[model samples]
Target: MTKKLRNAPAYIFLTIFAVFSVFPLYFMMVSATNTSQEVLGSKLLPGTNLLENFNNLVAQQDLGSALYHSAVNAILTTVLSLIFCSFAGYGFEIYHSKGKDRLMAVLLLAMMIPFAATMIPLFQLFAQNGLINSTAAVILPTISTPFLILLFRQASRNFPHEILEAARLDGLSEIAIFARIYLPTMRATYAAAAVITFMAAWNNFLWPKVILVDSAYQTMPMLISNFSSGYVTDYGALMLAVLIASLPAMVIFLVLQRAFAEGITGAIK
Candidate 1:
């Protein structure tokens, strides 16, 4: 009876979790399919207006342009971060100087300092350097986040030192070994970082809002923010826009599907 009761709890919690997780997705789809009026009336059943909502969303926003800006920025941020962070991680791990060790301590401290604390001073510095309202202002400030650096460093700890030593044995330069040998074997690491970086850049809100002043430069999040209004909020169209905005991150995770499992598997190994 006790063993049966233990099994009963697992089934109950799993059923509850599945419903909670799936309900939002179902509602989003239902909302997207209903007319704005039907949505306002709180209809839960899926309607026939999915395409219509999509059409309305396309006509309402410059979906192409907004997605393009988002894609470009996200790609840029991901690529630069992968290269720089991986290199920094490799350097800190491989070199092991006292100064670099101290810098790692500082990096940890920097992560503890809230972004809100630095926002005013960062804004002033960017303005003085003519970086405000520029893509650089958004992309550059975030390149060396402590979390990412530490993530890469942890992965580096698992790397086989013999490989690096062998490269040096063969007289290969450090940079060349990092580029050619280390990176190739560490594809899983890079793939894991890519998903996180892409999602971060895509959904980044506050700093982008501060720096990207032009309407053309606004992200999907900002677009969603302005979609709702005082008198007439088009819930169906808003849901459609959100669905579209969520696609890239979804697609990226789908592409790096293996990396999702890699972390868990690597941990056990």
Candidate 2:
């Protein structure tokens, strides 16, 4: 009884925080089912306009193509990033050397350079190569992020070198060792990386906006921008589109929440 009383304040604070965090999502969902006036009026109750809003969004926009482009960009980025970043991280930590440490420092320094400074050069290069408005253009710039590399490098510190050595002595190739041993051992870390990478790729806007010059290559973020860009925006359809756009990232994070927590804390298991 006494312990429960002592913990009451913490529980109360947590409950309040959770409500605050969740309220926006709830409001978004509610607004998706309401008209523009009701939404502006801040109606908290769910309305009957969900199907109408969805139909209007689909009829007015190429929602299917946007979803496809976003999914392709996000999945390819996440998979490629995991493979490359994990390899870089594994090599850096497992084969520790002075040269590698220096290189890692340089890479970290590169992170400090703002993307805005590099965007113009990147655009010029891509234009010279005639790769504008392609999925490759969108996916290329993001495949191996410094942050992901740093994340994997930090996680690799917890990997057991004994297993690596034993596998090598047993005549396992380096690739085989990584594939069979290190990969399996770092499942939680990989899940965390996937969640982060997928969310970033899915929500990426500025680069995609600059690179994907064609309307056919539009992503969900771009679609949302189009929906809200007009002088007379349909708030119901806009909210519905936002709800749909938000679902993928939300589902991925919720599914991987536990692994994400564990991985962030460097829990080996």
lDDT of 1 by residue, 145-172 (tens): 7777777777787889998899899999
lDDT by residue for model 2 (36-71), tens: 889989999999999999999999899999999999
In terms of lDDT, model 1 sits at 0.83
Model 2, C-alpha of 175: deviation from truth (Å): 0.7
Per-candidate RMSD vs. true structure? 2.3, 1.4
Backbone clash tally for model 2?
0
- The TM-scores, one per candidate, come to 0.91, 0.97
Number of the predicted model whose lDDT against the real structure is largest: 2
Q: Which window of ten consecutive residues has the lowest lDDT sum in model 2?
A: 260-269
Model 2 TM-score (2 dp): 0.97
